[model samples]
Target: MQIIQSLSEISGRYRALFVDLWGCVHDGVHPFPGAVEALKAYRATGGKVVLVTNSPRPRDGVAEQIAGIGVPADAYDAIATSGDSARLAMYQGAVGTRVWHMGYADESDDGFFTPPAILDDPLAIERVPLERAEGIVCTGPADPYADPSEMRPQFLAAKTRGLKLLCANPDIVVDRGGRREWCAGAYAQLYTEMGGESLYFGKPHPPIYDLARRRLAAIADVGDASILAIGDGPQTDAAGAMGEDLDLLFISGGLGAEETGTAIGGSPDPARLERYLAETGVAPTYVIGTLR
Candidate 1:
């Protein structure tokens, strides 16, 4: 893989960029030093940027959180979140209206139960038990710091009832200021292993990419040839790019850094990165130590 110093090298080649949020833009706690500036600079050069994230929050909620986390309003044009995509699946009648949401009642906002503000639906959402609901929707664990193993029984029980799970975030884990935290994908993976069917609407899944593509198309007339997906996770970001036939720019400092034997926020190691890439078998079009 080619190790690029700056996104500008490939910046001119693409009219639009689908940038990942958590790892590439900011850690859960703070924005990366040069990440915001890089995106702002890209937009200033007439590039349309869409913040694509596997966050289970609705697009508006994600946007607000990012803004609070220090990413300026002008850094990107639009946001397409997995929560929004998952809700669309529900709206399209892919799953039943009544959902048994598996996430923290306190940590979650109304976005988890209601439609996005863009849709302006007047109906209020009500939560039900797994037996009463027609399907399961897991935004994440009930506790932010809870282990995926703690929720295994619940997932398996839902599976026994033939309930399909809608995984809003397909990220197995994410870095929360250098600490790895379990995400919805971790639970979904275990559920799948236990013969549970799941519908994922995030990175590495075509549905989320399709939502991102539509958001990008709304702002600019760009094709897949002129679009690049920038992210740090190989299984989620790079694999998703590959599935959507989009180019990938992988950052080797966040979620995947551990596999490369590189500590979080450390300089990139070309040798270890190469080995890690080979192990994962996901080839990115470009590689950067971080999203500068």
Candidate 2:
């Protein structure tokens, strides 16, 4: 990995940037000082910023959370969320319409129950019993502070029903407010292990990237060579960038930080990170301690 101290060293190379939200930009509680400033600085240089996230909320809903967390609108040109892609799939009946939603009642999971956009073929997304449901839509755990084990029973039941799963957020875990928490991807993995088919619509998946590319194209005529993906998750961010054939700027923080002996929100140890990257076989175009 080419370890850099700040994004300014290479921000000018990209015309469009795909930035992650949860850990790279914010910790689900407050915006990172360096991350916020980095986005603002990148935008100041005429770079079109797209807030690409695995959040299980619509663009507007995610924007509301971003605003609430004090991330100014000037930091990003557009937002593309997993929820947006999931909703589009649901609307197109890619994954059946009638679904048994397995998620918290938070607004982030609202796309499963509410259709904010006009559907060409309107059909009620009725929440029925697990046995009667045609498919399962999993946004995340029902409790914000719960572990993946807490949802084992629900996932097993859904698996037994032979229902397919449509996971909005493919993030297994996230560092929310400096605390580690399980996400929808954890439960989806469990369901898949029990022989249930799952379709994920987030990082490491193509659908979410397709949606993000559209948002980026709307602002500027940029290609893969002119786009950079920045995030903290190796499996999600790095993997997604590679799959999309885009360059990546990996931040040494969040879930995979421990593998490289790097503390969350702390400076990275290059030697340790090199070993970790070699073992994982995941490479990035650049590596930074943080966004700044």
Q: Any runs in candidate 2 off by more than 4 Å, and if so which? A: 105-112, 116-118, 263-266
- Per residue, candidate 2 scores C-alpha lDDT tens digits across 1-292 of 5888888999888898999998888888988878889889989889999999998888988888889999989999999888888877776665576778778755455445567465666566777777677888888877857766766687787777777888888998898787888888888887888787888899989988898888888778999899999987877888999989999998876566777766645667878888877876679989887777
lDDT of 2: 0.82
- Listed in order, each prediction's TM-score against the native is 0.93, 0.93
Instruction: Compute the lDDT of residue 138 as modeled in candidate 1.
Output: 81
Top lDDT prediction, candidate number: 1
Assess the local accuracy of residue 126 in candidate 1 as a C-alpha lDDT between 0 and 100.
Answer: 54
Q: All models: lDDT?
A: 0.83, 0.82
Model 2 residue 194 distance off true place after TM-score fit, in angstroms: 1.2
Query: Cα RMSD to native, each candidate?
Result: 2.1, 1.9
Which digits, one per residue and each the tens of the lDDT, describe model 1 over residues 142-204?
A: 766777777777777788888888888899888888787788888888888889898988988
Candidate 1: RMSD over Cα atoms?
2.1
